[model samples]
Target: MSDEPAGLVRPDRRRPEPLWHQAEMALRDLIDQGEWAPGLQIPNEDRLCEMLGISRITLRHALRNLEEAGMLRREHGRGTFVRSATMVAGVRGLTSFTDEMQTLAVSPGTRLLLAQVISATREIAEALEIAEGDSVVQLRRLRLGNGQPIGIQTTHLPSARVPGLFEAASDVTSLYRWLKDNAGIVPVKAKEVYRVGAVAAGDASDLELPVGTPAFEVERITFDQRSPFEFAVSTMRADRYEIRSTLYV
Candidate 1:
């Protein structure tokens, strides 16, 4: 097929890198560069071995590495195919959904689900550090990556802190960007808690996932230079999203 890797250079034994590692890197580049797009079945093992001038052992090793890294999936009878890119969010950096997608070279989009002025519930009030029954602008949105639904986020902001937010909600693609530009709420930090759970019925429909599918439930409280600025809860597709962290010994 046209999407198959072409003009592949055989690994040089003179180089320090191992043969399998070199083959692995070459295939990774094809997937990352979108030359071999998601869902495209790759060339057969025998053909790839011939093309790369490698043995079945070396080719299989390279393929195994890619499969473990979530770049390819193998079918029992069918050949291996490239998997769609998974969106990775770090527990370390505080970045907006739009920024994250852009950094990964994916187009980001938002579909507003619900927007209204509401009285803050006790939980919402505490998260925003405001009084109970205070006015709050509530916005529910479906977050998209590459035009596909990836997450559903419900956000609450104090009305006093974000005047006219309800009216402008539909046009707000990124909550962080909107807060900084219009409400002067520059989020400097955030605390996020994650839980693994099954998707709710309504949310599953919005996220285009089967009911009771695995998902990531995240609750976050964002802070500005002054104080708490926004509170958000998100349901993200487990298959399409990942949370990453770094550790020190």
Candidate 2:
């Protein structure tokens, strides 16, 4: 809860790396050491600039990069605050929700909302690459972290591919874990798309957000070996979630 800016070393003029990158690294070190805990307001921009012995523009560049990396949050006229470290997913790994939460030291829980066998609609069929009207097992769940609602997840699987899923739905906590243990299916890769969306009434209720609130809509298709086996859509509270991606040339 210290309001003062942590002491920062001035960027080395002789270093080949950019000054902004150096400043960013210095701030990152402070955060990693817990000098600036989550939700703690940082010093004003002028103070930070003076403390780092850098210009305002250079300080802004470093702050912007940290914000994009989910290490800080800036509010209009309210200054900046340290953000809680969040779970990060990259393109190289297919991780389950439980695993992600566990890695972040957050307890994960799931509440089964709906579990039934339904005829695949046009949308579900297209996503799963199945014929319309074919039987599909639909599972709706409320995802929780540390006993707080985080998101709503709905999954569709071809009924023939996962027979008896409905019968074991009540005992399931992690869909990926169940798939591996019961069906011997392991997700090796996935393709996901994300967009900002207005929360629907049902999803809003599950996420404990007001209807029409902004949320993150994530649609994913998971593959076991080379075959697509699961299609899932998750609506997460934008305030509590951050999406991350790594790019390569």
Candidate 3:
């Protein structure tokens, strides 16, 4: 579950200690206890100041400390939000993009941005377990929902397996689902790693950000009965999305 902090408090003038520090401790407690879970947005600055009865500097000091500790993250002009240390439930389950969009009540669409075949570089070879100079199919697409560019997905499939997949999958909906329905490849288990980083220069323009704006990174490797079919890297806008995970005791 996501945490929504509504306990912004500006203290009365009669209080001996400052309100910001007090509010900071309260927020820290909230985070530690899973009250304000990671990737959830906290109240904005003005609301926080008014609720906590503290100056901007004091509130910022507490916030900066928490952010540095990896419990939170801040963005310019967007707002402050929780940063999950690990992938949540939604991210863990292996599912198609089509299914995810349906769950979120958004219309999913893809623009076939690029389709190319190139020799595998050392990095790609290592990741895909193919020899260097072996050809691979690289598909680049802009993933959209509700007519907004939410993310970019670049998938690399070994040419050995899917020689003509790039051309055949010209912006077709839901590669995973399509594969399962047509080619009889269904993923059983997949590994996904999440990281916080800036968008790359090449993708900056496509992502509609300055040269190096913050974004959510997901690098994943998926396997089907046939082979490791999907290795992709995704970047999402930090402001528009949040993280959720279930922790078992």
RMSD of candidates 1 onward, in order: 5.3, 6.2, 11.5
User: Which ten residues in a row are the worst by lDDT in model 1?
Assistant: 1-10
Per-residue CA lDDT of model 1 for 187-238, tens digit only, reads 8899989999889988978898889998999999999999898899999998
Among all candidates shown, the one with the greatest lDDT? 1
Clash number for each model: 0, 0, 11
lDDT per residue as tens, model 3, 115-173: 89888888777777778888888888887665667678888878777644776878478
Q: Which runs of model 3 end up more than 4 angstroms from their true locations?
A: 1-91
Task: Name the lDDT value of residue 181 in candidate 1.
Answer: 89
C-alpha RMSD (angstroms) for model 3: 11.5
Minimal lDDT window, size 10, model 2: 84-93
List per-prediction Cα lDDT, in the order shown.
Answer: 0.86, 0.83, 0.72
Pitting candidate 2 against candidate 3, the one with the higher lDDT is 2
Output the lDDT of residue 133, model 2: 100
- What's the lDDT for candidate 1? 0.86
- Give TM per candidate: 0.75, 0.69, 0.62
